[model samples]
Target: MEIPNDSPVNPEQVTSAQERGNPADMAQSGDFNNSNSKKKKAGAEAGTSRGNKSFSIKLAPATNLWTTQKNGAVKLRMEETCCGGVSPLTVAQMFQETVNQCGDHVAIGFKQTNQWETLTFAEYYGECRKAAKSFLKLGLERFHGVGILGFNSPEWLIANVGAVLAGGLAVGIYATNTPEACKYVAQHCEANILVVENAHQLKKILEIQNQLPHLKAIIQYKFALEVHQPNIYMWKAFMKIGEKIPDAKLDEIMDSQMANQCCTLIYTSGTTGIPKAVMLSQDNLTWTANTAGKMVDIKRAGRERVVSFLPMSHVAAQMMDIWIPMKFGAATYFADPDALKGSLVNTLKEVRPTAFLGVPRVWEKIEEKMKETSAESSTLKRKIAIWAKGIGLQAGYNNMYGNTSVPCGFALANSLVFKKVRVLLGLDNCTKYFTGAAPITKDTLEFFLSLGIPIFELYGMSESTGPHTVSQKNYFRITSCGKTMEGCKTKVDKPDELGTGEICFWGRNIFMGYLNMDEQTQEAIDKVGWLHSGDLGKFDEDDFLYITGRIKELIITAGGENIAPIPIEDSVKSKLPIISNAMLIGDKRKFLSMLLTLKCYTDDETGAPLDALAPASVVFCHKHECPATFVSEVLQKNDPLFQKAIQDGIDTVNRRATSNAQKVQKWIILEKDFSIIGGELGPTMKLRRGIVLKMYKDIIESLYVD
Candidate 1:
């Protein structure tokens, strides 16, 4: 388990940028301090010791790979904020703090039976303890991992914390994963217990249970069915087992936990190969929670709220929806995964959250909705909308350049048009909005910015816990992923002529390593402590990180011209409303070509496929808004109009290319869209290049022929 030291940066030299409001602000704001006091009072009133003491850990000092500079190359870390000198070491400890301070506050909210259901902090903590006790009663060993296959639900969060509270590691399995994928994770982690959401997930486990030799029990949370299996247990019955355990024993088990112990195993999406189980320790979780909480300026208890709709299996959702709230005492509203497809907009309207985190696709959908609304508006209203947006874009530029003063004219324009747009999108109350998980086009970012809503793009992976670089509210670049987070140092390893290199990181928030894959782990993390991110990127003059593309994904043409496909692909999709996806093809070929898929939309009223052709332009809809049943018959690649539209889009993208090698010389409109079920898209909705290229080998070859 020893990590070899390789070019470690001096600890004394590593420092984070000064945060907007320091500890003095917390002291000056009596409300902030009073909140903590109230939490302790509430715990005492509830007949429970809040355990307000800090859980400290001695972090190993590792050298940073880059030096601190204003612009040339990114080698910087942010200063850490002292929170009463008590850093939480484990998820259980972090929850204990919230229980003590905000025991009566709403911790989790979800819809059930057409009504909103909520769990208070005290009740949530109690359920976690019960789940932990049940694990102990079931003879689950310390450090043993439990697999959870489900969506974003209150039960999923409870089970995750419960397993960790019981001194066992929790492994989250993506609900969309095939049975074989689920079995691989269970076997690899030696999961002793499996918690599934419903019959659909339970069926997968049952089919592959024989392969999981170490799996001792299966627990179903909802949609319980009649089963006589000896190892299967209903949700209520599972809780009953914990009720029998003495409270003293549960407390002892929680107290025995350590900061460095591994608490969760997050499996990567496996875009390139079989997914790898990432081992994240208690320290990694807590450090990210604390740091990200400050970076986002999360509100004090009772005031902050966020909607949880993303997959719970992903690290971004886990950090934002679960762990960060535990650190800051924020409330998380869980949107039902099944209902999310039909009701995400309505849910956001109802929740009106203070903070929101979305992937690029989510933001793109919102942008499309705005465009559609504009197109449908009256002539004068449409004209006014365009005018207001222009003014807002100017204001956004001012804000990006650190101008605090707003122009009176721009403010007037915002009140006239932008304000209504914000309210309609359920973003009126959102103060902190972020987009990550994949590269977002500048068009999407600018669209939101021009509407007076700033979407900060961040950079990180599961290996970095959640985010390593984030955009600040006052200082942000539309093209960059903000600055390095506090207590974390970043470096561009072996920069090329343009200064682009592999993005490397070393910090307290970095993951311990991949589970049971020592060689792979060692390869990822060098002899020193730096974790080598396969993503290629560079830092701008302001130290804002810009991700170019993946090293493995770089395309070298037959003419020996190096080209980054992401930019070219992103450009085509951004400009062409009809194209759903654009995959560039040119490796070892004389000229570059592309594979394009038409966008599909379902009629809002009847849920039937809508015609792609419009009066003057083609309209594309979000992937989620399109039903799987209608995707196959929506568009024909051989149609003249479709082919002409796609060709025009490719020509437009080519016009912006710096060299001929980067432009698409030919393109084929695909009959079908890339899908997760088809193994063309990853869990995060990113294109699987190898799979796509292989699947259309004939089409690709045809493009190269005369």
Candidate 2:
């Protein structure tokens, strides 16, 4: 798809401002070459070739010393430095190395259905080899598309990396995708084979599998789980055949594909349309792993324990789960879907990971948990939390934007108040945290910091190799998405009071353009190769990039002041209990208003629900007074705990934006929760605001009709 020949800006956009601060300083820090450097560009650098390379996890210093069990079950015994290394390693090779050296090491701590299981490095590598060979035996050729459909599990990853071993690109479908959505991608990419875990996922693919005429095989991970059979291969029986392939030949076949070859199709989870299939080259994947590794400071020590819970189909989890750890041969514990509450907490205590990633939603849950349990703490405990949270936010800002102004008394505060706060959040053992994929409330963002968890908010898209801007260790601007990753150039197309504009990113990690759709691809990447992120941004006087909102999500009132609703919605929702999603409307008209969707957390099954609101008699505005989705019944059941949650949600967003653009007037109690299944959200669960506007067009009009 060719972009329309629209000349919006001058082609030469790489200004000194685009480079942010002293380019020389950043260059020294991140190995960045000046974009304005006199030298011309060349193709990617060929690192150590696979044959000459000992691509094992042991090479990373983090897992230098590991644990050896009496039963011959061994695992990584991490130290602080084990996870340290410049990353971006290939997943298949990481596994190869781990199995080769730490072959006996237990690599996976996975909980499936309800029971936990473990896979040793040797077993994990063997799994990938079989899967890869299975693909080849089933007719996978070089650069072929092998689609993956399922939730986060050992099987999901085994299939994804297996395809890589077979020299095929793994395109993961969101586990919750509708049949129609799945069909669109399968056909769009002309995938050669599709692998799924259970019968349910298979049912969705089977409905539309035939439409994907290019598909030659469908492999189900389980054996006994039978439904109406397709011309499919059972995973266990099929794997038996895969095991027969010689490992050396398998490496020969896959290695020949090279780093520049395409590795996966990462579908965009944009709210209003079919998700776009992001064509990631092997280089893109590795570069992302490399760039993100630098961003998070993934050291070899402690090799940073991580818990894999996010859907691996998306880039964040894919980077953290499938790519980053592969380079380090780090061990990741998988949370069980069933016993997630008890088991997730257990994993944190057991694994004590130093680094991890979470979405705003997950962080919110942690903040809520903190709020719920903190009430029972002593007065001194509460005071320390309040004081320490500010220092944490300052650290976050320092980590993101570059200028650091931590309070003078922080050392005293850290020792006195912040120490215990850290232990309560289970982040006591964690070094740093990554939260991204959507706007996050400042309160929640800072809360982790108060507890001594260095929560970093990052921003970017799959098109940009996962993350472009992230808070560095010393920078922390609550709203800034952090600084540009090393080797990236950023600029705002237009400036507001802040130097805010449409954030355009130019970097080596940018894609090789969207596959097949030359026009659309051309539209996204400008003439000089900057990927138009379509997100609004502003650099502070200090060169921090604050992501205001999506350009497409911008609402221009009749008065011409542009308001971004996310900050506002985030503020309001931060104070609310049981809010499923929030949509801020009233664009191109008068005052700002909103529509809120309220639903209980899936795991929040108790006598009193998270959906419960505060009493109408309280000083706080009830539905009768607020008129926002006034679910009186849910409100009547509201206990103090529930009320505090909702109020905190409200205060969170309210603290972010100015009053006019903030969620000033509101309505609540959407009929349904925003979900992938409900069409209210993107596959990643981001609210598709435009669809919500159109669906509730009349209500939005009513906000201004008077």
Candidate 3:
């Protein structure tokens, strides 16, 4: 109700509606215009229809819908989901034909230090077909499934396209996935060929190779620099086989690629449980990318040059790295292996990418940079910077999406101060700053938004083809996750008096269900067809959906009151200057608590510890005095940011609930952030809440103890 308030009504005085809104709106029949008997029949039908679906949209207020964002992004409104229409050229054709059209243009690349190994459209297509032919020579069938386990690189993407081009389904197992997890998917997919990156990756796959009956071929793209391995087929040797196929017939083979066939299987990181393989069809993927492209306008995409560092192993990265550029004929440049400071600066200066999509971690670093550099600056200077940020936001909105509400003086403010602010963050080249993979802290997103940097926070999962909803460039809000994609029917299943529930998605992009887990698939998608997202959400007066948290993850306490953890955690993280991520813990306990992580900052030169201005807009300590510690140290600082953040977290809970479900009573901070290597987080870097709870079981229990 405050700081980007959605509800016009005060949070304290809102009242709940009585009748659970009608689940269906049946057109009344002839004989009786809603008489008792007909009403009974109507009610029955409504109940049947609503059996799996949520409350009917006809009853919900409409203001909760998308209007606009400061991102300068335009919304392409569509009356229908463009399924079965222009029937997009399949992924393989899209890439090849684009390369054919833009032959000599540097189409894509992977980085090595300051240099880049480039591939023009022509070169890219040539490599794709040759690899495809070679894959066929290795005994790939029209229906064969090819699996890949690797880190992000051009090779990973090339092999994926080759599989699709050769009429094989590309199933990507998480490189971070365990041996048992890999075996399960490989066996279930019945993949015959496996393409892995290096010996270490291959070793993981080889551990369960004997258990996999269908796996017949294993090709390693990079040889282990350390030692020789005879069983693995070297990448260079494999390329030679690709020459065996006649070049004259390449086009003919690629044209036969079908759109409806399962093109890929990207398993979820399994933060919740066993990773479910999402069967992504070409039509589904093509549809999603095209839809998103229209919204972002990546075709006339201003920021044509992209520095892609996100994991290609994930769908979002694949969509951005492979699909977006192919659709727009844009040049995509890869950043160094490390998406951190040094490589980031080099890539930005060298490639000067026009557009960029970063997760919260990356953007937060930029925010941290602003605070660090301006540490000793006067209050007016910082406030002026904040004001200028608002101007930049206005200009960005006008430039990108064309809503253009900020008037002459506001416009003047942008030209004088905000424009330079954007360049400093290295976001001047960025046209659309996409925020996804996890919930972006609204405070952080707002800061970027105010600064004329466009940030789009979206919602989706591996099973939903990466995104079901995203904040439209022209129409967006800090609280809402934009409107649903054209055809998606999003609903809140159950509601307290407030009308929120388990989110259900039914759309063209919903995967062909989980791979091989037929029973689990059936359970996920009901008979009538609705992919249960498992996340809880509610739409506002504008029809924009605001997700709270996962239903299964919602902890019910001893008092039988259900508490959602994410909202509180998000508020806490957003308000803190140094806190990175937090996990909420209450479950069977009386009060909610949290496990926090502190972010380590670095000086501009060495990337070492540096001072960060607290939210008070005052610098607390210089490089020497900055303390690095856990929860105990944070409390000792007594800075305004810490107090504000902790208070905000509790206040958010109190404002949203009954007193029993208020802010957490206690919390602790861990020595480090959740990361993939430590297994506290997944490869995509989303925290595994369950895993954290287990790992810190004793630490979590202490708060409840006397």
User: Which portions of model 2 show Cα errors greater than 4 Å?
Assistant: 1-106, 112-122, 228-230, 270-272, 338-343, 376-417, 494-498, 554-706
**Distance from true position, residue 213, model 3, in Å?**
3.6
Q: What are the lDDT figures for the candidates, one per model?
A: 0.71, 0.60, 0.61
TM-score of each: 0.72, 0.64, 0.65
Query: What's the ranking of the predictions by lDDT, best on top?
Result: 1, 3, 2
Best candidate (score: lDDT) = 1
For each candidate, C-alpha RMSD in Å? Answer: 16.2, 19.2, 21.9
How many angstroms is residue 340 displaced in model 1 relative to the true structure, after the best TM-score fit?
5.0
On TM-score, the candidate that comes out on top is: 1
| Deviation (Å) of 582 in candidate 1 | 14
- Selected candidate, larger lDDT, 2 vs 3: 3
Poorest lDDT segment (10 consecutive residues) of candidate 1 = 67-76
**lDDT (C-alpha) at residue 496 in model 3:** 65
Per-residue lDDT of 1-706 in model 3, one digit per residue for the tens?
Answer: 0111221111122211111111122111001012234443432332222123221111111221111111111111113546324444567655544554565556665543223445555555555665687787777776567888876666676788888888777877766566777787788677878888776877877789899887767777754323344434655556557566665455455556555546777766443455566777665677677776666657542227677777676787778787777766777766665665445755565555666777666677777777787777888878777677766656655754456566456766667566667555555555666766655566777677676676777777777777788675676777577778766668888776787888888665677656656677777776666678888888888778898777566665433234566666776776554566789887655567888766644355633333332333222222224453433455466556555555665566555432343467787766555666567877787778878889999999998785
